[model samples]
Target: MASSMVAVGLALAAAGFAGRYAMQALKQVEPQMKQALKSFPKTAFGGGFYRGGFEPKMTKREASLVLGLSPTANKVKIREAHRKLMILNHPDRGKTHPDRGGSPYIAAKINEAKDLMDGQK
Candidate 1:
């Protein structure tokens, strides 16, 4: 019991010393942090768009826009939008394809857009 009490007292003293040191360190850092924050862009911690193949490649707004549908669109509307967009963007539609010789890239993007939008279904 005596040993335990000594250990507890040592722990409390160590903790108090550590806390005091941390408070002093924070006070030293506070002005520099304030200055850095003042120079930081307003977009910090917000309005971040995911990129570089990370995750969440398509936000709801982006998927909807790609499919030419509203964000609140139903499956039927999404399907219709995807179909209409695909008709114009399909790569092998051949002559009179609007793109004339439609590119595979556009078709892939259209298909991806459809898939993203239809994911909810």
Candidate 2:
């Protein structure tokens, strides 16, 4: 009984020491973690495209990017790009399983990009 009690006491002391060491280690790392986080950009990842809240009007540059076209692309190229994107991403294309395929939001964005691109010319 005394040997078991000694073993238990030693185990408890070792655990307490380990926990204290871990807490000290964390405290030392806390300032470095804060500094690293502070150095990061305020915007979300993907170059800030996934920002929260309401979206602004699509710019010409953004339209071109959506359609995978050059900013200086002509009307014919723009039309072709729009057609290709619609064929691939149109929500209606996912007839078999509505939720599993194309996204309505993406389709809407593609259409909006086409309209914006057309109007800017």
Question: For each candidate, what is the lDDT?
Answer: 0.72, 0.80
Q: 26-58 in candidate 1: lDDT tens per residue?
A: 999999999987886643124354344412466
In model 1, the Cα lDDT at residue 41 comes to 61
Give, for candidate 1, the lowest lDDT window spanning 10 residues. Answer: 43-52
Cα lDDT for residue 120, candidate 2: 50
Model 2 lDDT tens row, 4-118: 9999999999999999999999999999999998887653223446434325887887787788777788889989998988888878786998766677888888888888888
Q: After superposition, how far is residue 90 of candidate 2 from its true place, in Å?
A: 0.7
Best by lDDT: 2
Return the clash pairs for model 2, or none: none
In model 2, what lDDT does residue 29 have? Answer: 100
